[model samples]
Target: MQYVQRADRKIVGYEETEYDQNRRNSRDQGKKKFSRTMALILGVVLTLELMIMGAMLFHIDFHSADRIAMVFAFAVLYFGVVAGLTDK
Candidate 1:
């Protein structure tokens, strides 16, 4: 057991066992991996969405409901993905 102090006051006494330290390190590593994976997936999705939108806009062929629907779907998906990733 070790005593933790602050400003000459003993806050508490707790033992930081090796097992606890190892568990904490593993959890941190997992979070890093998850964050990296999410960032990569989101980056690819966003890039593809932007490219498609740019092509459609430059062509000026958004005259059909199908095209508009597709754009709308992409917009919804983009927002949904962002929200989902950020909520974590």
Candidate 2:
């Protein structure tokens, strides 16, 4: 049970059942897990992409076109994943 008071001095009582609280807690946990997982994924992907670009910039002997293509592919894939995540 909870009481909410308005600025006008009106009082309102609300009942929060245990089941409701548990369900809310579980939902929050799920969202946190999802966000963490997505963050990890994006971080790894971005790191790898940066490393590749850095290698290319330093003349690492990789074919220029191929390296650029790979970077572009990764960017597209990342955007797709982002779209999917945001769709939820």
Candidate 3:
């Protein structure tokens, strides 16, 4: 357990902020593993998407609309994953 000492050098009982910070720290420690896993997955997905986009462009099938869609989709998915799993 972690603790904070007050200005007077006395150990203060856990305040709400301290509790929240500790909770966030613990949660983030666990989520480090999850984050690494997700990073691996995202890397593969992004690579595949890039390959597909490249192939489409090579075939002259790429459109401005497709690029826009891909950008927006990637942004939304990235934000959704991060925000959905993050601790306050």
Candidate 4:
């Protein structure tokens, strides 16, 4: 594989060997893992937001109170997804 970079308005080419590809793949995997982690965190936040909104609408109703469990549930799921995607 070969990669080209623009330096000083000129194209510079570098030969990418198999080892380079492996390293690049690892780096790309890291990026993917980070994105997934962010997405999981966002999901948790959104769940909490929805739960809060629901509770407000219900005005302390029992069914709405049940949604409070969703916050912890979603948090666990978020961590699980992130941990599964990332390498130890």
Candidate 5:
């Protein structure tokens, strides 16, 4: 079977072989899986950040809270951007 696609205002037509289809599907699936994994990791990291912040609020050992918070914030921001791009 064949399909048509539009790119850069140009019309293109191509036929995908069985092997090509499987390869494409696997690559797409891998992106989805990686996005999910990143989401889970982001969630865990955020949770740790909250816990650490809460500990500092409760007057616990959080002398390095500033450094840790920055790390978690950047991690979440980076992963969030990656997830958003992959989902679309």
Candidate 6:
């Protein structure tokens, strides 16, 4: 966290601001594992994603626009959300 100290409140002559760097930044927070909730979500999402991939890969009537739409929806919704899933 960063904090700035302003001593002068003048409208025309603004003094320099002091910043504190002792606190850690928000981005430097500790690691976050794939929680149980996320795991459950991943399981369901992965199952459907794999099924779609199999259908598309094996050329098993995966030509429908609906199928393509399913793929796009998964990418837009779940896959990106699970991108932070880590083994450790």
Error of 6 at 46 (Å): 1.8
Q: Best candidate per lDDT, number?
A: 2
Order the candidate numbers by lDDT, best to worst: 2, 1, 5, 4, 3, 6
Q: Rate the local accuracy (lDDT) of all candidates.
A: 0.70, 0.71, 0.65, 0.66, 0.68, 0.60
Badly placed stretches (over 4 Å) of model 2 are 1-11, 33-68, 78-88
Those runs of model 6 whose alpha carbons end farther than 4 Å from true positions after fitting are 1-24, 61-86
Residue-level error in angstroms, candidate 2, position 68: 4.1
Q: What is the model-wide C-alpha lDDT for candidate 4?
A: 0.66
Instruction: Name the lDDT value of residue 44 in candidate 2.
Output: 63
lDDT of 1: 0.70
Instruction: Kindly list the per-residue Cα lDDT of model 2 for residues 1-88, writing each as its tens digit.
Output: 7799999999999899999899889988876434757765875677577657877788666564487776787677666666665455
What does the lDDT read for residue 3 in candidate 3?
78
Q: State which candidate, 4 or 6, has the greater lDDT.
A: 4
Task: Name the candidate, 1 or 4, with the larger TM-score value.
Answer: 1
Instruction: Using lDDT as the measure, name the better of candidate 4 and candidate 5.
Output: 5
Model 2 RMSD in angstroms: 9.5
Relative to the unseen true structure, what is the C-alpha lDDT of residue 35 in candidate 2, on a scale of 0 to 100? 74
Question: Model 3: residues >4 Å from true position, as ranges?
Answer: 15-26, 29-45, 58-88
- Name the best candidate (by TM-score): 1
Residue 48's lDDT in candidate 3: 64
CA RMSD, predictions in order: 8.7, 9.5, 10.1, 10.2, 9.1, 11.1
Model 1 clash pairs are: none
Error of 6 at 62 (Å): 12
Q: Give the TM-score of candidate 1.
A: 0.47
- What is the Cα-based TM-score of model 6? 0.35
Q: Write the per-residue lDDT of candidate 4 for residues 14-62, one digit (tens) a residue.
A: 7888899899899888653346556667666766676577668867575
Q: Candidate 4 at 13: error in angstroms?
A: 25
What are the per-residue Cα lDDT tens digits for candidate 1 across 28-83?
88764347567658856785877578767877444544776767866777666666
